[model samples]
Target: MTTFTDLNLCPELITTLKDLGYKQPTPVQAQAIPLVLAGHDLIAEAQTGTGKTASFALPMIDRLSRTPVEGEYHEIRGLILTPTRELAAQVGEHTLEYGRLLGMRVISIFGGVRFDNQIRKMKRGADILVATPGRLLDMLVQKKLSLAHLEMLVFDEADRMLDLGFIGEIRQLLAYMPEQRQTLLFSATLNDSVEVLADKLLREPKRVAIAARNSASQQVKQSVYAVDNGDKADVLSFLIHGGNWRQTLVFTRTKKRADQLTAELLEEGISAVAIHGDRTQRERTAALAAFTAGEVRVLVATDVAARGLDIDALPQVVNYDLPNQPEAYVHRIGRTGRAGQQGRAISLVAPDERRFLQDISALIGKPLQLQPVPILENGKLIEGGKLPEKKRNQSGKTRKGGANTKAASKAAKRAPLQPEEPVAPDTPGKRPSLFGR
Candidate 1:
């Protein structure tokens, strides 16, 4: 029954929460806010939609509000590092929204945009800076900013940063900050590498674990359709249009697949857009906004582009292609079923991708409900459509009569891309998207 008001937050924050209709603190927020306010270097294992941004933002804002730094010149006091630009922008936007009345200045810095604008903002100095590692490092090297006055450092989504190869930059950034400052590390999972990073950065950190490590949100209803790889797009289009889905987020494996999927969806009369590393900042922002506003019904994204994307009330998430890494799958469906909301995640699994599905099931410790693909064929719903077998060409004829040929084909179907971690052997366990609108 603990509420935001009972958490000893500042009156401005309480009022703002009321205005924003956030009646009570989420589990992570309720537990983490007090620890942060107490000035503890903490490690919190929580996902994106658990109101985690507010958990740390509220306390940081409260402390900064109590003691406003005043001078013609401004020094950076708070720093938050995120893996993707989308997430950095989200954290920066939330900080400003919560701390706006307190006269706190916040800025988000990342690559893909012109540097002069960020440099101009840096000249003014931000009270709270949310940035990607590379751009922040660039600013540091150019002597455009200093962390000498930094009092708080937050590494939001630390595991994702490690996955994206920011460990060295993170270390370099940590070296510049004062060791005495409070550090808060938040991530969906605290794997061994994240633990090592926290050990080096935090000082006897108070640990707050909201869930078991590397598990998907319990609220998501996960299921998969066993279909042929060639039929994935047809199945995805059928589900969106046939099921009458609104505001679906689809995840694809590659940027090229994302772009192609978007085009395919559009051709099918679905309003879809693709967001990836190749998209300019403005395009990415516009695509996200359109999807959020329901102007676009579907948003197709790659694993990298989807990081730190906070879409509210997203009811469905589709995986057009299974991710190579099990952890990546966890983060993809995480886009929906957030903040205790009921959500559905569906994956299109080809015969070749069953092993990938097995890898995911092992990681999550549960088997996903498997159903045969239902297809619209010849003006009727067809269940378990048999895909056409390939004919023998030059390569197939070479091995056609070999005794081991059948076994070799089976082995090839079973072979999956190596996961970052060992694929758990197929055991009894819980079993276990898209480009554009």
Candidate 2:
């Protein structure tokens, strides 16, 4: 029965949370907020959707509110570093929402966006900064931002930052912050590297774990569908159509795969888009907005979207391509089943991906139920695992204007539908459907 008021959050913050419809503190917030409020450095290990952002944000806002800054100079008072631009923006937004009535100034900085505007925001001064390591480092080098006045440092999704090769950049950024600041390092897993980072960054930190280490939400019903590599697109299309999934977050192994899957889904008349490292900030923002607003039915993404892409009441997640690391599988499916809502995680497993599936199962400590692929009546071949032939024909020759590819794509979009035949129905070895549709 713990509430935000019981957590010693200020009246302003309590009112804000009430307005935001957050009646109770999540497990991470309940456990970590006190230690942060007590001014102790902390290392928190929790799942992605466990409200870890507020765990540090609430306390930081409270401390800043009580100690009111007197001067006009807006040197960064609190710094939160994330792995990806999407996560940085998300954390920044959450902090702003919670600190809205407190007169807190928050800014998010990351790469792939114009520096002119971010520089303008920085010049105006920010009470809290949520940023990706690379862009933050660039600002530090350019002397556009400083962390010497920082009272708190939070590294949200610290493990993912390491996975994205930001450890060196993180180390450099830490060197810029004051040595006496309260450091909060939150990671989904406490691996050797993360532990080392914690040791180097935090001092005698309090440890908090609100969920099982490196585990996805148990509320998510997970399933796997065995299909040929060539049939993955068709199978995916069938599942989306048959299940009538409205807002699905699909993960792929590579940026190319994300784009290809998006194209395929669009061809199937499913409004879809891809977000990845190569996309500009404007493109990424537009895609995420479209997906969040339900303008798009499917969002095909790489691991970049696995951690920070928060969609409210997202009912389904699909592993279009299995990640080589099992921890990633946990984060991918973690996007759904958030805030205690029921969700489904569907994985399309090809013959070559069996090892990945095994690794993921072992990491999650449970086997995913095998689900039969929905039958597509038309036998038309939908290329799945292979590279898209839009640019080059099957003969390995570049097509002029890609006319045939456009025609084929149009045909796929306009194709008529037949009643789906349930694959592997009533088989002796068949497992119960996890999706319950």
Candidate 3:
């Protein structure tokens, strides 16, 4: 029964939310927004579509405007650090759109863009500054901006930052903030390092967990297929060709694979595009725009595009390769089944990934129905674990996008790697039908 108006938010912010057509706050928003509006440091665990952005953004904008202080030039009042440039840009855009009604200045800072432009913009100072750790550090060292005036610090994807080895750099950035700033750490799930960050950065923080551990969004229905690596593309093509599916998001493990897969899909008359770290800011933005606009029927990407993707009614997410980490499985699939719509997540697993698949199923505490692999044109099982002789023959040196195998040329390289982990399924001992030709 709690609505944005009932949360004791400022009238202006309430108006903004209403104008944006968000009449009710999400669970995270309803609970955390009140505490945040009270200037309390918070740790909120919510999935991608849970409106966590407004949970923090509305309150931050209100506090900056309602509470008057000696704001200075070239000093940011709030800092939100995310793990990737795409996320940073997104948060910045959201802040700008929502905070504009309040006449606020919001700026996004991340690497892969010109320093001159960011530096020029930073001179005037900003109310909300969204950034990536690396670029923030670079700007800090260059004396482009100072954080001494910052009143709020948010780690949007703390666990991701840890996985990306930014703790050291985060430590460096933390040293520059005032000891008495409000902190908000939001992520899909918390690992040990994130716990450490909350313990160290927050002061008497209120912890709000909207999602349970190892649980993917309920909005998404997940399934898997145990097939040989050779048949992944064929299976994907079949799924698209056979079903009423309109938009599908496919995840690969590396940038190189993303590019190659996109080309492969195009060759098969399927419109596809790939996004990764190697892509320029413009390229990534264009690809995402095209996908959102339905110009691209399928999107092939690495983990870089997995997190912080805010697509609505995405419908389908194909784990062309399962993620090595179980948590990533949650985020990748979360792209679909968003905003309370039904969505499907499908994983293609090879024989070698059986144990890994089991691990993930165990972690989620449910059995992922295994779709039997359809018969390929050839009367074989489709190289479940090994690379197609064609892929190997095409590049005996191995595809640059495959999993890291340089360390062990002796392990008998398989067709790149299909990701996996060993966790129990939510449904107990449920044996799914394994499909094969």
* Residue 323 in model 2: lDDT: 75
Residue-wise lDDT of candidate 3 within 1-437, one digit each (tens)? 88888988888877887888986878888889889888899998888887888878888888888754455553578889998888888889998888877778899998888989888888778888999998999888887788988899889978777767677687789888899899998977887667777888889999899889768888886767655665566557656754646799998866666777788678768898988877888888899999999998998888865568778789999988777677788888878887788998888876666666777888788887455432232322221233444542221123233421222222233364344343212112322221110
Cα deviation at 303, candidate 3, in Å, is 0.6
Query: Using alpha carbons, what is the TM-score of model 2?
Result: 0.85
Q: RMSD of each candidate?
A: 9.3, 11.3, 10.4
- After best superposition, candidate 2 residue 27: deviation in angstroms? 1.0
- Per-residue lDDT over 310-340 for candidate 1, one digit per residue giving the tens place of the 0 to 100 score: 8888999998888878888889888889877
Total backbone collisions for each predicted model: 17, 0, 18
**What lDDT does each candidate get?**
0.79, 0.77, 0.75
Off by over 4 Å in 1: 375-437
Candidate 2, superposed: residue stretches over 4 Å from native: 369-371, 374-437
TM-score of candidate 1 relative to the true fold: 0.86
lDDT of 2 by residue, 9-32 (tens): 899999999999998999899999
- The CA lDDT at 330 in model 2 is 87
The order of the candidates by lDDT, greatest first, is 1, 2, 3
User: For model 1, where is the 10-residue window of minimal lDDT?
Assistant: 428-437
Q: Each prediction's TM-score against the native?
A: 0.86, 0.85, 0.85
